[model samples]
Target: MATNNIKLISPDSKLLQYTQIELKDPTDAYLESCFAAIQQNRYTIESNTLVQIGQTNKKS
Candidate 1:
């Protein structure tokens, strides 16, 4: 069996997510992509949240 590496690209072509799928069977992968697209914005928001948390911890 072969595998395909796919990256969920953002509107600006940034990499929002990544996954490996079986080349011969990608149905589940497609469904996952749909969910990923909906949650893509969360990725950036989460990243910012982490940075803010880190800074707050450092100050405490």
Candidate 2:
């Protein structure tokens, strides 16, 4: 079987709220549940500042 890595990030209360939510057990009991859970998390990336910086700055 092939495996891939993934990452998740969040702040405190949001993290705690996320932790409290329950997931249904997989019928196949696949080990991929870990990856699925991580993929299911909600995230917000701050793209505004990053877009401005990249546009305003140029590399030499």
Candidate 3:
């Protein structure tokens, strides 16, 4: 498994946070698709996991 650290910043640019995501050798295309899905509200982070809306299984 590989871990990636993503920096979360506030809209005001005053606050910053970091989250670690684990994946199995994730590729750039996979990351980009995840970002797009998140922006579209198709996926969300819950309990340190990425879950697709309308689905019961978590995406790793």
**TM-score leader:** 3
Q: What's the distance in Å from true for residue 57, model 2?
A: 36
lDDT of 2 by residue, 1-60 (tens): 212222224443333222222334563234344334434542232442211112245689
Estimate every model's Cα lDDT from 0 to 1: 0.45, 0.33, 0.61
lDDT of 3 by residue, 1-60 (tens): 222454547677833343435444558557656666776779877786889988577889
TM-score of each: 0.26, 0.22, 0.44
> In model 3, where do residues sit more than 4 Å from their true spots?
1-26, 55-60
* Model 3 CA lDDT for position 9: 78
lDDT score, residue 29, model 2?
37
Clashes of 1: 0
Ranking by TM-score: 3, 1, 2
Q: Give the range of the ten consecutive residues with the poorest summed lDDT in model 3.
A: 14-23
What is candidate 1's lDDT per residue for 14-56, written digit by digit as tens? 5545564543457666545544554554222353342122223
Question: Model 1: which ten-residue window has the lowest total lDDT?
Answer: 47-56
